[model samples]
Target chain A: MVAVYRISAIAVMVEVAIQSMSVVFGIAGQGKWIQEGGVLDKAVIEAREFVFPEVIGYLIHGLNGTILIPLTALILLVSSFFTKVPGAVKWASLVLLAVAVQITLGMSASGLPVLGALHGLNALLLLGAAFYAARLVRRSRTADQGDRLASRA
Target chain B: MGMGYAEHGGHGGQVAGGRSVTSLVADPRRPADVSVTLAAGKERFRLPSGRAFDGFTLNGGSPGPVIRATLGQLVEVRLVNGSVPDGITLHWHGVDVPNAADGVAGVTQDAVRIGEEHVYRFIADQAGTFWYHSHQMSHEQVRGGLLGALVVTPPEQPAETVDVVALVHLYDGVRTVNGNEGDVRVTVPPGKRARVRIVNTDNGPMSAWVGGASYRLVAVDGTDLNRPDPVRDTGVLVTAGGRADVEVTMPEDGSPVRVHLGGTTAVVLGSKSYDAPVVRPPATTLDLLSYGMRASLGFDPNRPDRRFDYDIGRRPGFLRGRPGLWWTVNGSIFPDVPMFVVNEGDVVRMRISNHSGDVHPMHLHGHHAVVLSRNGIPAAGSPWWVDSLNVADGESYEIAFVADNPGIWMDHCHNLPHAAEGLVAHLMYEGVTTPFMIGGTEGNEPE
Candidate 1:
């Protein structure tokens, strides 16, 4: 149980760090796009002139918002059942909802600057919640006397 | 002047000096009936010869001419077509005249046939800087040298030592000045204050700057004079068909000044200096919204008599149903549409609607109006003063101002090429009569 807890905590930290880095990189990329006359401006003059569409597609299909995030959450949730960790399923569900809301907001206000900021903010919050859940799971597992002793041995 | 026929690749050859070598100057004070012969014939035109077509202009020179007229004057022009194979018409852009006098082909009237002459007559009631060019097939006609400035001055203007009109013509990569790839240099004298009117007649948008002087913006689109807002930026971006009148108090003693435009710069110095000094604008507070608000300054809001909402956009037929193409107002082109009428001295509220996919910078010639609301919200915080407002896709703005200045005024987009693509109209003030007749001559046969 202690080993399971240690692994969960490390996974959460890595996920949070990656999410934060994504936000920073996304903002920098957005600024560059604006200087290049924004997405719409570029699309009008030269449809296939820019490479931003490829990046957007990658983020949508391959990044945390799609494959990695759900896969990670599923693994963590399965581990929760095996370890009998309380609140793990609830936290996972909340993180999933947060991601849904962020995507919805982004789609609704795709062209607006405010929406972009909000989407970034929500991603950070979701990352923080995931990390908190992992910490809780790790702490709960370590609370058991047998698990702590096994780790020490 | 004999027509020079050169076997060039294109339809016609370039003329030198843009204007005909044969000088024909008309007196503004005297009523003149001028016959203009516009033929599509091959002429031997030289580009800025030394620079290998550095000044690639039609008819041959850089800026064509300054067409001067007085307020309340009647003028007639006979347009004669001489081009090869294609018929043409001259659209008097921004001149508030009758529909028949508008000079648009296929909409208001048929194209002037080759060897045919069309007579146009209109009273100059509005005082401002306007222009005229070919309306039949604009892209080539305007790119050629068929354009000239039309300045109608008020009967009585404040006396000044120097009243200079600088028509800034910008050409893209195809043309240059003084054999330089990207430089057109202009000079202004030192130590003398001058009222300079800058007009942008380029197909594309360009920014203008005076290297060594700080100038105060006095008027926009020939109207709305308020406290000066001076910019220290490299240059002021003059969208196509936009005009800015500035008052510059030259530097002390004998400082030289240069007016730089479109990467090319020109030096105009004091009477003494052979090479003028480049004047730069000093840091100053920019008050872009201080004009046209007597109510904000403790006066009552002078409400206009009537308010109208104009849905400005393109028709489905214009771009062949190609969505998000071409700009228009109320689903019609300029010459084909009727003018929006308002009573004299009536405060008018014009709600401009933009349904086009692209953003349009709308400009009102001969008047400056305060932007009351944008997107249905009061524009109180943002700078509420502008003659040109950028109306984006699916947005609307309501602007209010008095229609005190009687005359036909042009209400159109500031983007020149877009205007060429059919985004122009007129704002007419009722009960205004002129001593002379205005518009195209009826029953006049083509030569």
Candidate 2:
């Protein structure tokens, strides 16, 4: 159970990293397309037109942010209840909360572009939370092994 | 443009030995019966409902001046681009105008840039509810308010019915009726009937229902239905870029009757100001597939001269060098999409299947098609003619149309964003070609 929880949390961290890279890659490609005299307007963006080769980054980022990350976070939260590691459930809850907020921010960023900054910020926060949650399980296992060794000594 | 369609075989192997789109126009010898000038501009305008929006406008308003003309009249519209930088072209939505007058930027004609003027001359051939919007950068311009209602009455119109144009639009996410955020009241005497023309100028389908009284869907997409029955407690789903005309009679008690648009906005018709009861939206919507009386389709769809598969699917790929999940037509992305080629007057049938996990309001310019079947079930309702048909995810539709209008017509998803996302294709008439090019110095991105 602890392994499942740890793996799920770590998976979220990896997914968040991919999401960040994908979005950055998408924007960078869009910027270059515009620089090369390709028109990038609201219509193009709304139509999700692949005017450039790097537009796949947006598709990847969108799928990871909306589906993969949320699924991984939910699994971590579910497994946290059975992990038996102290504070594992609390850390998992924080990671899930950040993900929920992250999705909301990402959805609203189009209408209110100012929210995009917070969306980026929350992604980093989610990554940190997932990393800490995964580390907690490893530290608990190590402490348990040390306790047994001390008792034997 | 640097990105060319050289790989797509340059006009789908049917480009040469064709007539130019410029020659397929209304009779230039006849003087225009109705003439109007529309100035396109981009400005921050405030609606009467106290809502402010920064968007595109036609002749100083979003839902621009209603261009009304009698049937059989030659309509001439001179479009002048005042200040919009991206350019603009007026598309006569739902009106089967001549191929040259069908204002599709880069398809029918080039986008009129700033300070430039383009004149469209076409006879108001079919008399019904229609509209006009910008085809240049339509995904943004149309949503930003570059559209208006175009109503064409019959040569001898009925004098008894009160006509109300409810040009429904969502400006910056705020739903409005005729540019107002609330109910637009039309003064109809008690017991007098009124026809509410609901123009859904949005991305998705909108549900329209009557609140206080039963209403009959008289016309859809500018084509009159064959004996449509009165609908009570049921909503009519109007596809994006589609129009629905609902006829309602005011209650003799003098209370206003509300025609709800997409559940948020409405058009209230009453003798005086009186609160109309807000009826709860019915759980079930009207099944248009088998709603009204059936009639002859003029042409048999079973024996079509040409059949095309407009299968809409989505996959991760590179389009114009942009990498992302993009909408596809026949499994090929934009510039690589199919150019449906057919001869003029040929009976064309198209099977539009959607498995893209999203709904797409497919709109075909220049011609209106009748729905033959949905998911293999033949249409049992009225002729059910439509210029735009909404195909939900996992739904398959078979539609047929007579290829009478000869030009390069755009058959694309009306969800402008989807069109931009590579969900666009052209219905090219055999031996018809356009000189206009997309993505050039003119910046003609006609979504």
Candidate 3:
């Protein structure tokens, strides 16, 4: 089945580069604790130390948009319906509708920072449609589908 | 041991820092009274209002000369450095000098480099008013000009009536006093008595005032205020690296007295043709808490065995990899802040609290503290002491101090970019140990 549709298009291009490096390292770790508690007064009284790598980069960018891009788009829609190829069901349904609009633009980017810069330009359009749907599963293999059935003999 | 250091010992004795914290409260000297030498160059100054910049000097004066001495003498100095760029030391800010001359560059030495030469020697032993800068990257060699003026006297050098120093700097962005920037005359004859001293060295908090005349706040930071009193309509301020003095008198109808220090610079004193008043710093200043009268803090700050607090604030973290909006200290940041410790005679008692909106100053290098109350009230004047305080924002003070100068000192922020944006913190003492290291590969970075 075209090698199981190239292993679900390499897990949807590694979950679009790990959810775009977890929102740019969670905007540089919550912009450095909102600029170190952005001062309110009563000067430095420290002791709040728990910052584990910006809390595991927003918990792996919220589990790569709610659990690794919906389990790699349901394993690329059941390996593009058992690989019947030919536009594998519209490129696996446009990579599961761009990972469901990139998880609703990362939950509407915390109330629209221009939708968080359009969720970082929609992760370069979900890594260029997941590297062109993993190169169309190597052009639908099976020797390019017997050279497209001998060019429609 | 020759990266070149001299050290000696006695001001409380530990003088080498294997495990030491200073404490000299005076009465030690054994020969050596007043031998100055300073150097440190790389100038292009000129500022008493005339305008010119590119600084970093000492013997060439951007404020690098005036050492003086007498009170308990012993002094020395030496320092050479020659072409400042990433090497220079000095730091006597409030003059406790000991934990190995406390110059503090990569801790207490290592940075006399550039052309090298160090000495120091201390012992002016608590007199009145002090100053000295360049604790390495002191926010860029003290705002690019290095610093100076450290007086002491009182061992009878009183021919009285005219002493002046004003030091107040802020170059590259203008605003000067000793390095000029505007009207700098100071002749003083009319009714005599001038004094002045001033020295804020920028980074914030300045205000000076005298105008037509009536002064007498007489010393602070270098101590000696006790019976001071006589004001006019108020102005004083001076926090940032702090220092005051004042005195005034002048106008016996010669009428010029200016003084100022903030805007249009000023010093004028005895008639440079009066008419310089327009500095504008009045949102309420001269509070010195109560202004002066209390007394005897000989000890017993309600009994502080040690108590810290600190507080400050402002978040968004990662001081070591460069993120923004830092300045925490107690809530942590900067190499993880909080060290405080203490023991040398331990009296401690901190309680700072700023809330972070702004105004910090703070600066507790060797030790002078004393404030004892602010938002919670208390300080009925006179024991204010301070070694660079201010703490504005939401405010909260309560100082105290008596660990009697030991070793790992620093307690940060004289606005050196808010201690380079982390706000800093330290106090160590219990078995000091600094071989010196802040940014390693050895470039110090002492803020």
Best candidate, lDDT: 2
Instruction: For candidate 2, give the lDDT.
Output: 0.85
Lowest-sum lDDT 10-residue window in model 2 chain A = A40-49
Per-residue alpha-carbon lDDT of candidate 2 for residues B1-447, written as tens digits (9 for 90 to 100)? 212132222224445586888898999999999999999999998865778889987888778999999999999999999999999999999988888888888777899989999999999988789999999999899888899999999977778899999998877666688889767778998888899988988887778888888889999999999999987889888888899999997878888998877655788888876588777668778877897899998988888888888899887789879876788888878778877877777888889999886778899989999999999999999899999998988899999999998888888899987887778888877667678778776677888
Worst 10 residues of 2 chain B by lDDT: B2-11
lDDT by candidate, in order shown: 0.53, 0.85, 0.72
Name the candidate, 1 or 3, with the larger TM-score value: 1
Chain B TM-score per candidate, please. Answer: 0.64, 0.96, 0.35
Query: Cα lDDT for residue B20, model 2?
Result: 86
Q: Write out fnat for all predictions, comma-separated.
A: 0.00, 0.00, 0.00
Candidate 1 CAPRI classification by DockQ? incorrect
Judging by TM-score against the true structure, name the best candidate.
Answer: 2
Off by over 4 Å in 2: A1-153, B1-16
Worst 10 residues of 3 chain B by lDDT: B1-10
Candidate 3 residue-wise lDDT, A44-137, digit = tens: 1111112324646667777667766777677777777877767776777777787778677766564455876776777677667767766877
Tens-digit per-residue lDDT, B1-447, candidate 1: 001111221112232222210111223356654333333332334444242322223234434445677787776776665542345566665565554565655334556666777766667766766666666555445554455666777878655435666665433223232223333333444556666666655454444567556766666565535444555543555545556666666777666556544433343534555354444432332333333233351212345565666667654444333433355556654445546666556667788888765556676644557777767666543234456665656888888877655554556665545655557666654433222122233211111
Interface RMSD of each: 9.3, 11.8, 14.9
